[model samples]
Target chain A: GAGVSQSPRYKVAKRGQDVALRCDPISGHVSLFWYQQALGQGPEFLTYFQNEAQLDKSGLPSDRFFAERPEGSVSTLKIQRTQQEDSAVYLCASSLSFTGGPLEQYFGPGTRLTVT
Target chain B: QQPVQSPQAVILREGEDAVINCSSSKALYSVHWYRQKHGEAPVFLMILLKGGEQKGHDKISASFNEKKQQSSLYLTASQLSCSGTYFCGTEMDSSYKLIFGSGTRLLVRP
Candidate 1:
């Protein structure tokens, strides 16, 4: 119960439709990350949030993909005009420190999005 | 760029040993290892920093060679629970964004 939690374990979206996925990081985590995983490939970075500030978003595939960590604890990833290429497993991870040591981030079960 | 992982998949018997290597073209600041089972989230396995301070569970060891810009994960005495796809996340920038490689599927047979 103390680990990261993601809502809507699965989602189905139509072309040109929009969908929002939510992620709740571990309590007191300072760093949050969003990643997209294809069927058999490893997760690819999408965006990152250090507290409420989104430090890096260069990994975002396109402007249609938007993510925000409003209060720095809960984050949401919204995809506008969903495309078949957007179909993938969305993962959320959180870490306590960024300086070093136990730098590992905890990941949620992830939401599998199917854009048909 | 995403790091390259070797031996796309491997089969091991329980109690056997295995090593997973992650190599990056660019200088690596750190390497994070994780394992993901079918239909599950990736669980953190270990973290190796550039300087030192390698964090991992018992029977699992990792080393980060800053000069080589790579990391190696050593799995000592494999177990059934160790059966999963292993991923190596490489950090080149200070922003904490990790570029993960195509996972290596590892099956530990009992």
Candidate 2:
């Protein structure tokens, strides 16, 4: 795809189940970011990756949340023991660079995860 | 703190104008504007880096006031295609993370 691509556009998982969301950012983009958006709310930062390195994970809601980008191309966000509160739209975005104060970020369609 | 967007929603007639404002309680580094339709990803519209600088696309323009920690988006001579939810994303000190506002839904009536 020409733009950012995400897998499993919609997922419904039972409580205590595990789920993984995948994101394929724009090719050659160096910066990737994950955000979680609850119903009727704006997206909140969850993690950030600069190339293959996980620069920051401070925004992860809990230990159950994990993300990895092994080769600076595709990234995955895994959530274990899902809870009702875990339901939200997971969004992935990528920018051309990270050093500048602000870079235009291209966003994916986002994966809607519903934990029931 | 999350930026506050005023006029939670607005309704406009074709060829009209609308203004959406976003304000932050804390200092800000930059402001980004994006528009999202009913069920799609937010698309980048414009970015304001310097205070008092205004950038425009067609009839859409935006201004940033560094001292007030606020930014406003102006849509002049609006068209039907302009109807959508507008969100203001802010960054502090150029942090990698962008905090987006709740959003303001705009409805354009023909």
Candidate 3:
């Protein structure tokens, strides 16, 4: 693909329902990141991946939030028992490398998740 | 932690200039600027490394001060196309994750 891609541009889930958002990073991108953005707010980092390894997830608000990048190419963010507060735009970004330098990040359109 | 962005919002007339500031509590290794228009993802603007360097993209320029943990985005001769939300992402010395600020919304009127 030309750029980072995310599935289900918009998703509406009832409270308590589980929803999964998929992200396909740029091919061969070594770093993948997931962020949550509430209305009128900036995107907040949720998790990061270096290849197939999950490096940091301290930003996950609660145990209900989970993310995985088993194949290192595609990632999925699953929310269990979604609450109305969970309604936000989930953004996915990928960088070519994670070294401590100026790494350009390409972002996806983002999935607007709405929990009723 | 969320970086502090000053002047939550600003309205500018075409050909005018505006400055958006971002400051972080933690020591910053780098500061990244991004602009997002309505219904779109954030577009990368520029990145300032640890050193005191200024990078410019067209009329948009940014300066980072590693010591003060501060950075400012400078919009010269602002245009209507520059109307959007600007964000500053900070990478602290302690972590590799990029934490973004609340954002500054800019509206350019003709």
How many clashes in each structure?
Answer: 0, 0, 0
Per-residue lDDT tens digits for candidate 2, residues A32-102, read: 99999887677788999999999899999999999999999899999999999999999999999988568
Q: Isolated chain A: TM-score per model?
A: 0.96, 0.96, 0.97
| Model 3 chain B weakest 10-residue run by lDDT | B91-100
TM-score of 2: 0.97
RMSD of 2: 1.1
lDDT of 1 by residue, B1-110 (tens): 88999879999999999988899999877798999999999998877878745556788988887878878888999989989999999888666788999989999998
Error of 1 at A13 (Å): 1.0
Residues B2-98, candidate 2, lDDT per residue (tens digit)?
A: 9999889999999999999999998888899999886688899999985678899898999999889999999999999999999999988777678
Deviation in angstroms for A43 in model 3?
0.7
Q: What value does the lDDT take at residue A2 in candidate 1?
A: 91
Tell me how far the alpha carbon of residue B77 in candidate 1 is from the true structure, in angstroms, after superposition: 1.5
Count clashing residue pairs in model 2.
0
Q: Please give each candidate's TM-score.
A: 0.94, 0.97, 0.96
Q: Model 3 Cα displacement at B78 (Å)? A: 1.3
